[model samples]
Target: MLIDTHCHLDFPDFAAERDDIVARAHAAGVKQMITISTRVRKFPEILAIAEKYPTVFCSVGTHPHNADEELDIPVSELIELARHPRVVAIGEAGLDYFYDNAPREAQAIGLRNHIAAARETGLPLVIHSRSADEDMAAILTEETGKGAFPFLLHCFSSGPELARVGVELGGYVSFSGILTFPKSEELREIARTVPLERMLVETDAPYLAPKPFRGKRNEPAYVAHTAAVLAETVGVSAEEIARITTENAFRIFSKMPRV
Candidate 1:
């Protein structure tokens, strides 16, 4: 069985046919999915999706793009909200200089707050880093020193140095549909070297659909395509890739019940 470790099934893109999308995912061998949260304030919507689907779980954190709006959302509140049975990880948060939709400073501050919540709750931090590797690594290093916490670089599109540092820091690296791009050979090399025990796969659905399916909306069912490419890149059977990555995901988000 496969699991789309990170997706946005809660997004409006699935509002009209959410059940169909999820049913298709299950039909395609996707046993579970984590509908990631982008803003703490919108957590109810995220949680609602998880509650409605037994195969779905939720994460609670502010995305870097929404950092400014949620910078004031206390870590304690995040911890409190995360106690829910359906909430598994704490984020989709980190720095995103590529967009800079939120001030860089605010992004950094909010990331630190997320780190605090993760450390306090002993829940994994689901991080998003884009064009801001140095600062992201620096903060993760500093925050881990304060207290150990699990974390995963979701839909990772960073440099080898950051990938190296992330694994060395005991964190996992999750690949997305972007890995299937023809120009992503370099990223594929990195994926190849990632230890199987510390690697994962995601679709980041409603965006970044894999090749043949590229330039189109993505969803959990397409994670199989990404996994097939990863299996070829990493020299493993797709079934093996499915088993291990699913196990890695469960290890990071222990709060999520196995399907």
Candidate 2:
């Protein structure tokens, strides 16, 4: 069995066939999926999806891109909302200098708030970082020094330095369909060196479909393709990759019921 630890089922791309998308994922051997949140105000929509499906779980926090829009969202509110049974993580939050969708200062402040919620609730932080490695590394290092919090670099596409820092702090790295792209050889190399115990896999769907499905709509079903290449890169069997990532997922998202 495979677990797609991160995805966005609430995105309109799946609006027409949301149930079918999730059904196909189960048919393809993905037994569990976590529909991640990007905006705190969308928690009801995210929660409704999770409540409607037994295998789907969710997270609650603002994406770095929308940080400015949700700056008033209190850490206390995030912690409170996370009390829902199906809400399993604290964020799809972090810095994204590549887009600069939100002010850099707001992004940093939002990231820190989400980190605080994760630390307080004991739920893992689901993070996204791009083109902001220097500040990301410094912040994670500073945050780790203040107090340890569980986290994973979701859809990881960063430098070796940040990857190493994440592992050093006992956090995990989740690879997506991007790993199957030919230009991602460097990323595969990083995957090779990352300890298996600290690795996870996701599709980040409604985007990043792997080879054959590349440029098409992605869903949890295609996590198999990413997992296959990840197995090849890490010198492990496909079944072993399945076992390891699933084990790691359960470890961090401990709120999920054992299957």
**Residue-wise C-alpha lDDT for candidate 1, range 1-259, written one tens digit per residue:** 9999999998888899999999999999999999999989889999999999999999999999999998878999999999999999999899999999999999999999999899888889999999999999999888888878999998989999899989999999999998999999999999977999999999999999998799989999999999999999999999999998999988988888897
Identify the leading candidate in terms of lDDT: 2
Q: Which ten residues in a row have the lowest lDDT in candidate 1?
A: 139-148
Q: RMSD (Cα, Å) of candidate 1? A: 0.7
Off by over 4 Å in 1: none
Clashes of each: 0, 0
Q: How accurate locally is residue 166 in candidate 2, as Cα lDDT from 0 to 100?
A: 92
Q: Model 1: which residue pairs collide? A: none
State each model's CA lDDT, in order: 0.93, 0.95
